[model samples]
Target: MEDFFKGRDTGLVIDWTQMPTYNTIMAVAAGAGLIFMYMLGRALVRDRDFRAEGWALTAGVLGFILTATGLHMTLEWPFATYFPFDNIVFGEPSLAFGVLLLAASLFLWKRGDKIVAAEDRAAEAAATARPLGIFVLGMGLALFGIALAGLVFQLFAAPAEEPISGIVADYPMIEAIFMSLLFAFVGLGAALFPIALRGFSSTRPLSGTAKLVGVVWLVTGIIFLLFGAMNFFTHIGLIVNTMQ
Candidate 1:
């Protein structure tokens, strides 16, 4: 019993049962990254504030670094990136990469601050003052509606394997169905954004491809949160028993 407890603390051995708790960290990392990217992009494009956007992007890069490292460390290599997952260690290289990001961001920020003309700045300020609340709100509702439609489809159309089993299962069908659902929901959420924007009480909030980015992000975040939470507590009785 003592050995088992020690193993859990050290991460040398996994319970297999508590996978959900650890994956909560991944969901957070992904969610936070998505939101930050969209927010900073908005500020950069609308305000033309390079310094702020650069720093924000730098921090986001750091987050991805840490999150990717965690994933590699936890598994052999969950993602198929070129980061040499097998060799990623929390060592000098990681620190060096972070330093590099900081330097690049600072350089861009300084350059951006210096280049914009006064007239451009004035125009940007005017643009920022315009109300976008109604536009954003309508988009949010549409994304939710799309996500709900996904849940309804899942409930009625076809059966899916239990969450954990489907995740690590060898069966191709289970994995395929789940991945299909992921694409379905994400696509619907994105596609619905413009349609929702058109039907808004206001004429139009804004226009561009990036307009729907946040809607897709929020929908994805909710989906991950739901799956991670469900899997986490699936074996709650076992969790409590182990604690005792």
Candidate 2:
């Protein structure tokens, strides 16, 4: 077991100066993603009729915020070198938020039966509850799965032996597999956004701003999926080049 473990070597260092400008762009995009997710979550939760929907939206928003913040720090933080855990593992703040969101989501799921039973006594209540339930359930599952996977990858994945070369080399195949799974989960969440929006629109009379936000979420999710797919291709290209 000791032979399988290696001591950390600080000699090799990540050269942030050589990092591409696009990394900054990615950081900004991640920030925007958080803001947008938060806005959508707020809109979903503001109505009294959508309690489940609200909690679900809140969980999703919180999860995205955690993910985006983590990405931003990884990509754009200048002082990452000062903190030993900065890049060695996921950012502590982000991981906390992710875990919180997952807990809230699970809470909602466990209490769903009681809520559904109570709403079944009235026709209007049943009608509204059904759609909200569906949307909330879908969002909860997607967000919780994504967040848990990320947290596991960050906390338990082996660290690199050398600091400068980064952790990618420590467990390259595991990192690749984890990244692929993460992106696929994100894509799954994105794909469900429009469906949730449509369900919300059908069941409730959203304000003009809320409707616009829904549309933006729908469009942005599409764009995010496209960008993610491109990233996948780019990774594949890099792998091929490395092999050559």
Candidate 3:
């Protein structure tokens, strides 16, 4: 048995294909795995009003997916370095944030069984929450505007009339997808913040959907934005170290 096991270990146990289509399919499969888990959890968990959670408190679950993906990417760096250091650059923080999200989700669950909107008297919050939300809306738009301008200039004019050796090369599809996500995240998220603020600041309680939207935007936006900024610092360090 020892001899047989040793022989089996001699060759690679996981020989992945080098085909791009295969790799894309693998990525999609991994994402589908997470969604499957989310759907399963959604079907299983219930609320006080018998409402099963959709994306509520699913950050923790998403965190777990990220953590797994990050670790896998990091570990498989040699075999899976699609764009060079992509794994190390993205994986570590994803693992950390995943853990943080898990802790936060547990705390929410322990305190309130699930994520519940603070339906405090809107009259009480209106004086504070509404104005604050509007302020946040402006800030979000400002940040998004900067990102948009930077991307536009970088993709268009920076190359002196046409983009060269940049994101719009052979990876136009990837670039398009990224731009779409950016627009959706920043535009939709910024758009929702004020409305959510309105709901939160209303004289009456917030609707369930509104509460969900607000919470998703606020929590997800802050977390990912913070993580992204941290990634910039990490990349700078890498560059400095490489130069040294």
Candidate 4:
């Protein structure tokens, strides 16, 4: 039994060829990003009724998906080979984001009625529930740090990895910069959440900062969704290239 188990440990037990797990991860993350946009927009609208429970529930579902996948990627280092650090870059942040979303969703579900708007709910929760707010803010800061690292460290141009590199063989630098910028965009949006939450919570009225957060999330959502969808095709190319 020990000999047999040792033989199995030396080889891959699971097949990844048919499963585009990385792409699925991005797709789920994109979905969560879009939900953030919707939630923010709904919060920003003056006369609209913010359905905190429904939206928080939806976001929680996506958060669970991200958390599961992110935790796996971080711990197992599934697809990353040439650059194992890449897993840390993507996985840790994803895990943190997922946890934040889950936490926020739970709080909103419980004390949602206390908040008049989505922004208010967050701000109110932060004001009342210090820990949750701080956690969200910490995640936002972590994302910002990631964005900074991507820029300062030039993570985009680190190495021409598989599918992404193959897809943008012609314009590698451009695509790399674009990808890095996406991180920056999303990070900026997240970083601003605390500011928006605090600013609007006090006045309990629509504020410019909140509007800015909405715009950022909306743009981030569109870009992330499109990028994630495009990866569906590129990931196939990766599989084919590897097979060849």
- Using lDDT as the measure, the top candidate is 4
Model 1 C-alpha RMSD vs. true structure (Å) is 12.2
lDDT of 4 by residue, 133-234 (tens): 466566667767766666666565512234655545555456557766776666676667666665654336657876687777777777777767766766
Candidate 3 local lDDT, 1-244, one digit each (tens): 2321122333212212331111222233223333333233232232223222333367456566666666665566643523333343345434444554454345445533322443432333233335556644654565365446435543211111122313244444444445334434544554555565455433355555355554445444454444344434443443333221
User: Cα miss at 156, model 1 (Å)?
Assistant: 18
Superposed model 2: Cα runs more than 4 Å off: 1-101, 118-204, 242-244
Which scores higher on TM-score, 1 or 2?
1
Give candidate 1's whole-model lDDT.
0.42
Could you arrange the candidates by TM-score from highest to lowest? 4, 1, 3, 2
User: Residue 62: error of model 3 in Å?
Assistant: 2.6
Estimate the lDDT of model 2: 0.44
Alpha-carbon TM-score of each model against the true structure: 0.39, 0.32, 0.36, 0.73
Better of 2 and 3 by TM-score: 3
Model 1 Cα displacement at 150 (Å)? 15
Query: lDDT for each of the candidates?
Result: 0.42, 0.44, 0.41, 0.61
For residue 72, model 4's alpha carbon misses the true position, in angstroms, by: 1.1
Q: How many backbone clashes does every candidate have? A: 0, 3, 0, 0
**lDDT of model 1 at residue 96?**
32
Residue 244's lDDT within candidate 4 is 19
